[model samples]
Target: MKENVQQILAHFHIKQFQHDLIHWFQTEQRDLPWRKDKDPYKIWVSEVMLQQTRVDTVIPYFYHFIEKFPTLDSLAEAEEEEVLKAWEGLGYYSRIRHLHEAVKEVKEKYGGCVPASKEQFSSLKGVGPYTTGAVLSIAYGIPEPAVDGNVMRVLSRIFYITDDIAKGSTRKKFENIVSHIISHDNPSDFNQALMELGALVCTPKNPSCFLCPVQRHCRAFAEGVETELPVKTKGKAPKRVSFRAIVLMNEKGNILIQKRPPRGLLANLWQFPNDEHAPTRNDESFVKEISERYHVVIRSMERIGSFEHVFSHVVWHIEAYKGNALELQMGDETNKWVTIDELKQYAFPVIYQKIWQAYE
Candidate 1:
């Protein structure tokens, strides 16, 4: 078995593969700005921003962020609020926080330079095996394989591996194979080519095998099982949460946006204070609870349209209600009332932004 694997590896001609991939990439790869420089900071930022985000979706954000904080020193010196504001539409707020903290740590410890070694890079917050591998390969020319979803799918199809690719063990298996073949010379282009091949030609569904540079070496294509490899595990249903948002507005067009507790969902982000599980219809108990909590005289309540916002693992059924505040009082220190013009001053979750836009 070892000899057979060795024979297969030798036949693939890793250098030729890398050379062909780089040639294809130079001609066909998308013209992204991050690809223009080998700066570790830019590469690190692009890798972090691209997590759970599509390349097209991240382009504008990346350009804007790069323009705002061009260097590692600038990013390290910037305020957390500014960072979060820059990352507003990008979900997974924790990534932004981790990146912000990592910038500070890298600046203080590594003299504002992103670490080049995999071991040292992985020590930073939010830097996992994949991120470390990506940064090391792309920024420092280390022979590390950055196996992500696209790479996994592409590799599975090429090797005709039908095992459930969703398992962590399956990922490790693929990484082992990749680590063996990844070339030390220009591993960055090889890693990027693998990703681009997957994204452009070897797509999950309806892959354009004719356009693939590696089709001749693909075992799955030879076996006519290209679509069947890389079996996926079934996804669990997302948890559903229901909440009522008390949209308090005064005659002055100022809206009441409360800051949630420093932890939990939308932590420290602004939102309209309301009951956790709002009743299906109007209930006196729910109304009373809101009145007591805010300590404000409720003049009248009018129901606004409900909207559903779905996250990766959670779903929120949000019902908006316009409340008339009689006695002007900020109930909680964590909460505050801001004018419509001040909306841009704070970092708000995208779901709330949708509501605010609709309100406006």
Candidate 2:
């Protein structure tokens, strides 16, 4: 069986594959903002933003982010709140938080130059295997393989590897294969080519083998099983949690918002007063919870609408309401009153943004 695996691996002519792949990439790679220059900082930022996010969605954010913090020094100097605000609409708040923290460390420890060495770079916060390989190979022409899910799928089909991609062991196998075959002539374009191929042609379903640059080299395509090679198991469904988000407006029309805990999901971001509750909880219960929790007597409560925000682990079913803040019976450091016009200055979660856009 091991000998048979070796035969299959040898069938994939690495040199020809590299030439076809990289040539296709040089011709067809998308004109992305991060691809314009090989600035490691920008590449790092783009990678973070691109995590589970669509390329189209990340484009404008990348432009805005680069404009706001053009250099690692500027990003390192930024306050956490300002960074969070800049990354407001981009979900996965923790990505930016970790990147911000890591950038500060890079500034202090590495003099704001992103470390090219794998050991030093991976030691930084949130720098994982994929990130380390990507930065090093792309920035420094290292021949290390950046085997992300996309690369895994592309490889699985090309080599007819039947391992389940959902398994970590399978990922390790693909990474090993990539390490052996990745281009020494141009590692940057080779890695990007694998990713681009996965994105454009070798998609999750209905792979476009006809348009594939390396179609003649694909083992799965030869057997007419290209779509069936990269097997993956489904993960557990997210838990559903209910929340009642109360927009408490003072007589002057100033809305009250609070800061999320500094350590959990949506950490350090601002939001309208909201807390998890049982779905069976009524409007009176919501008002009571807010009044008791914030020490405010809410009057004229009117339910606007319901919206759902799906996180990886949990789905938030939010019920939004508008009410008058009759009196401030107590005060908390985390809560603040800002005018509706001033709300734009604060960075709320995307669910709140959706609610406000609809409500406004």
Candidate 3:
């Protein structure tokens, strides 16, 4: 079995494959903002934003982010809240937070320059082998492999590797394979070409095998199981969680909002004050709970309806209730009353934005 696997891997013509892929990429690669230059910081930002997001979705966000923070010094010096606001609607708030933190490290420790060596780059927050490989190879011309899901899928089909890709161990195997076949002369174009092939030609479903540059060398194509070659186990379903969200409105029409804790899910973003419990709680109970928790009195309560937001691993089932606050006995440090115009200044997740729109 080992010899057979070795023979299969050895059959691929590395030089020919690299030549065709690079040639095709030069003519066919999309004109992206990040690819305009080899600035390491721009590459880092683009790579981070591209994770779990489509290219079309990221293009506008990329442009906006760069406009706001054009240099490493600009991003590092910016406030966290401003950064979160800039990253609003992008989801996965943690990515922006980590990017901000890493940039700060670069400014303070590395003299406002993105590190060129693998060791320094990997030490930055949220950067892994894939990110490190991408920045190094693409920006610095280092001969390293960036084996993301796209690259894994492409190689798995071409070499007919059936290992379940969900496993961490399987990723290492794919990375090793990429290191072996990556073009030493033009590592940047080589890695991007493989990823582009996976995105455009070797898609997850209904792949356009007829248009593949290396179709003649694909083991899955020869064996008639291209789609089945890249096997991956299904992840567990997201768990459901319920919450009771309270929108406390004063006589002046200012609504109450609270900043989430500085860690965990949706950290430091603003949202309506909420408590986790069964969705069966009535308006009175919700008002009473708010009064007890924050020392505020509600004169009248009305059900505003419900909203659901799904995360990668959890689904939020939120039941919203709006009420007029009759009295404020004590002020909570984390809670604030803001007008509708001021609400726009703080970053709210899409779920909260939808709720606010409904309320308006």
Index of the highest-TM-score prediction: 3
| Residue pairs in candidate 2 whose N, alpha carbon or C atoms collide under 3 angstroms | none
Q: Model 1 segments beyond 4 Å from truth?
A: 1-11, 251-253, 277-283, 327-333
Off by over 4 Å in 2: 1-8, 277-280, 327-333
> Order the candidates by lDDT, highest first — what do you get?
3, 2, 1
Output the lDDT of residue 57, model 1: 89
* Residue 340 accuracy (lDDT) in model 2: 81
Q: Write the per-residue lDDT of candidate 1 for residues 111-185, one digit (tens) a residue.
A: 998888777789999998789889999999998879998888988887766668778777777777788778677
TM-score, one value per model: 0.92, 0.95, 0.95
Clashing pairs in 3: none
Candidate 3's residue-wise lDDT over 1-360, tens digit each?
A: 133434656868999999999998998999999999998999999999998899999999999999999999999999988999999999888899999999999999999999998999999999998999999999999999999999989988989888888888888888888888889999999999999999999999999999889898898999999979688999999999987887788888888888888888888888886776334357666666777766677887777888999999999988877778854753465778878788898999888888887777
Q: What is the Å distance of residue 132 in model 1 from its true position?
A: 0.7
User: What is the number of residue pairs that collide in model 1?
Assistant: 0
The model with the greatest lDDT is 3
Lowest summed lDDT across 10 adjacent residues in model 3 is found at 1-10
Lowest lDDT 10-residue stretch of candidate 2: 1-10
TM-score of 1: 0.92
Clashing pairs in 1: none
**Candidate 1 overall lDDT versus native:** 0.81
Off by over 4 Å in 3: 1-8, 277-280, 327-333
